[model samples]
Target chain A: MEFSLIDRIRERTAQARDDVRLGIGDDAALLAVPAGQELAVAIDTLVEGVHFPRGTAAADIGWKALAVNLSDLAAMGATPAWALLALTLPNADADFIDGLATGFAQLAQPYRLALVGGDTTRGALTISVAVHGFVPAGKALTRTGAQVGDLVMVTGTLGDAAAGLRLVQQGGQDDPRSAWLIERLNRPVPRIAAGLALRDCASACIDVSDGLLADLGHICAAGAVGAQIDASLLPRSSALLDWFDDDASLDFALSGGDDYELCFTVSPQKLAATQAELARLGCGATRIGRIVAGEGVCVRDRDGRQRATARPGWDHFAA
Target chain B: MEFSLIDRIRERTAQARDDVRLGIGDDAALLAVPAGQELAVAIDTLVEGVHFPRGTAAADIGWKALAVNLSDLAAMGATPAWALLALTLPNADADFIDGLATGFAQLAQPYRLALVGGDTTRGALTISVAVHGFVPAGKALTRTGAQVGDLVMVTGTLGDAAAGLRLVQQGGQDDPRSAWLIERLNRPVPRIAAGLALRDCASACIDVSDGLLADLGHICAAGAVGAQIDASLLPRSSALLDWFDDDASLDFALSGGDDYELCFTVSPQKLAATQAELARLGCGATRIGRIVAGEGVCVRDRDGRQRATARPGWDHFAA
Candidate 1:
């Protein structure tokens, strides 16, 4: 039965890749990273209730599980290559497995990523995925390269997923805008192309999983710099702006997490080129702030007055 | 608090290696798999109640989690290099994290394996580890190389861990031999040296995570061959033999799981050399069977008559 489920997954995710010498069904997988590239590896786990709503669809869970890890790779400017999934299920529900495989394949096929190997066990429902990707040696972006005077930019809009989560928690699934917001919450688009474009231009890069204020704070802390953003400058989707008032929408963008967009820093001289490159890729970059020589992230209004926040971002343990 | 916990783990598991360009602190880890080597990757997840008893020590859980993954690498004759650990806990238990880190570092330090990156979240206790290793291209031991007329051998002893599990489950924790048995169950040694020794000569190799019969059956199926084993010749540790009667001990050796020993096949000409190499490594090897021309595994009694069994090994979904 376990073999059948594994076979089902393998058949669904079958992609012919020459680098994957030995994939699923083996005790371990053999992979060949092209000769001059460094391997970037990341792993993330999503518990049923903590990561998604209790009754979330199995397909969404599968897609998001792989999406989160791919986001990590995206943050590092790595091209996705392969993934390993460790699925803990409450029982041997074949339908759940089939739905999950379908969801995983949907995301993986676009990146040409192969599902190499993994383990399935009986337990509370949980999904863990580890992704391996490749980046040219010395070219991977990191959080420690943000320099003073660099322009702080982000790809795509923020706060949509967090708002989506709020609507879901408030039982607003029937709302007309819920589908769009929930889609943002459930199936985040990892900015792989933006990251690849930023490889040569961005000084520092990070994905916005933990909200704008918090994730940008990570870049500041890592690079020994500070950042200031105009509260009026945060990019918001039309749905977000239409759903909430000014302060509430800005707050969601500031402190609410799970955006999965790329928050990066580029030198002033490279900003135009970076924006043009991203525009060509169809996800235009939005400049929101600039790096300064301070210790933490700060936000200001149009009047140049500082704004205060209770917390900059979400911490799982703190919650 | 999350950063502090991560800091504690990083400080404890730090090992300076040139290939580890970035470790632990970034969105993803950057590793350089040496040129001309293939990367071997494997992942495993162990849940609280399903993998161990409710009150098992955090340290033991940590050791076993890494041991299982390392055993997979050993099966492929790959040298361990780096690891990523995703730890899920019910809460922010500092003491548990500390103990777990200590246990993980204890096993990892000997191999110089660095804990490169991972994620932590709130959930039922689960430890998912993805390990990456390096093997010379074309040198990995796999299950498809076994041929007819090859000798079937196993390293260390089989059934000790299963016997240990039985004792623990039966409330015999305080038995005179309980400590020995429980140790086997909690911390089975991965035969890295034995695998390295057999790399050039072993026709096929696999780690016995399932029972001897079940795991060997996988080899037979993969290699398109059959296997015949003399049940009486199966190896049993003195501790296992002294605790159970002949039939029970033999049963455990045949179908009991959780023994992380290597079961491999070698051509008849390589038998003496393989045994000598393993003996030099201090684990030694025992010849219990031979690869044959049929399709499934068969067990024989002293009179060379085949014996039938209902099932071969444990399956997580089936259980």
Candidate 2:
């Protein structure tokens, strides 16, 4: 049998790079990691009906599969480079492969990310992507560096993707606001530029993949420091606000996931510089909270009282 | 939700390497690539009832997941160093996770391949592993270099795994020979030492995952050359010959896949040295055929007449 699916993907995502000595054909890929750089690697698998809704567009699935992994690199402040895809399909459908490749290339072209190697197997529709990026020695951002006095911040709006998912699930995609929310759910923009600007200055950084509370909880756990965030300070997209009341939108923003926005902590002295750098990149940043001495994340209302989200953060194995 | 599964894996596969600046529990792993070394990366996905039979033990699944990827590195003549696992399961069962982690670490510890990062999600059982290795710049093996007149060789016996699967399918596993064949199927040894020995000597190399004909066909297709092999000289384990007739065993050896042995081509002058070096490593090499001028693989009987096999190599998408 001809694996023309691979052929089509190769044709579609074909990219030329000096560092890729061998890409997508041999027993494995041969890549030249630039001298004085550390390799940042991340892998993620998206299963139909679990990671995405049951009938998400193939293009959207392809774009989101790569975007989430790139978001991981963004959290590390790594410059995206090469990727390996292990895509599982229910069958060998050429059109699906075409759509997936088109969306994948659309996201990859801007970053000069090369699709180095991949394997296609017959199974449930699932895509696993392993991305490798470069970060200068000792400069790669991590989740273990938050200090007691660092200010916590997030890039872009948070609740849009989650609200989009809710809108789609509820069949609420009739108006422009719903369309924007659904787009957020389908194609999240990875903050690669903002992350690069945060390197060496951000005390700790993580992409709000599992929502602000849960992912920020990770930074707190890793750093042994707590964070106190003012819920009212979260930047909400106008489209999200149009569909839901402030309280509902805030709940989604606080506990909903799939945002792909960078949530980071930085020293107060460097806060202005970090914000300005991100501003120049056009990604922008919003101050939401600050690191404290205790453990776990604390969410406060506009009146400075503790608030509880209606839903916990997204968990893969949640009952 | 408790993602204690990750903690379980972290405890079981905790390996220390100075190069792994940060391993699991991070947004992306930070790994130091040795200076002047090119990185070799490969990814493969195995799905239940496709790559392996249904109800296969989690440990075997985990072992084969990493083993097949290591075979790719072995084919490239690279030193295995790090891996990222993306496992999809129907549910997060502790016993299953334990078995999988144990099996993964069993193979990983020997090569010091750190489990750098992973993602687990709910779905039909599927495991995708991306393995990264290192080779001196310009020394990595590839399939595009086989020249006409190069001796085609393989390390270890082939078709045992395929035959073993056949026995299990036929419910023929009641004796020691059956047990041995099943073991071959479950835990195919990757020829890392033999491949490393091939280094600059072998003109081209490929792992025999999709059978000898299909995989050798890759080398031929990649090099625009053909190959001719004598069926009588094809290596088979004693247990395979004991269970099946000569003709059937030959067919299995030629077209049946899942054999992780290495198939390579070396110039006639270096053949003796390559064999002797592999012998020092106790892996042993067998000269099975020669690269010829043309395309595709040709099998010959002892009397030198072209022979045809009943089955083609394994195609994941084949119906």
Question: Each model: TM-score of chain B?
Answer: 0.97, 0.97
lDDT of 1 by residue, A213-257 (tens): 989999999999999898888999989988888888889888878
Give the per-residue lDDT digits (tens) of candidate 1, residues B1-319: 5565456666777779999999888889999989889999999889887777777788888889999999999999999999988888889888998888888888888999898887888888888999989999999998888999999999988888889888888888778867887898888788888877889999999999989989999999999999999988898989998899887888889998889999999999999888888888898789999999988899998778888767688876764
DockQ of each: 0.84, 0.83
**TM-score of candidate 1 to 2 decimals:** 0.98
CA shift of B302, model 1, Å: 3.3
Runs of candidate 2 with Cα error greater than 4 angstroms are A1-3, B1-3
Compute the lDDT for candidate 2: 0.89
Clashes in model 2: which pairs? none
TM-score against truth, every candidate: 0.98, 0.98
In order, the Cα lDDT scores of the candidates are 0.88, 0.89
Q: Chain A TM-score for each candidate, in the given order?
A: 0.97, 0.97
Could you tell me the lDDT of residue B266 within candidate 2?
A: 95
Residues A1-319, model 2: lDDT tens digits: 1246556656776778999998878999999988899999999889999889987888898899999999999999999999988899898777788888878878988998888888988889989999999999989999989999999999999899899989888978776658888999999999998889899689899999888998999999999999999988999999989889989899999998999999999999998888888888998799998999999988999999999765658878877
Query: Could you give candidate 2's per-residue lDDT for residues B1-319 as a string of tens digits?
Result: 1246556666776778989999888899999989889999999989999988876788888889999999999999999999989999888788998888888878887787888888888889889999999999999999989999999999989889999999988877666669998888888788888778888699999999999998999999999999999888899999999999988899889998899999999999999889889999998789999999988899999899999765658887767
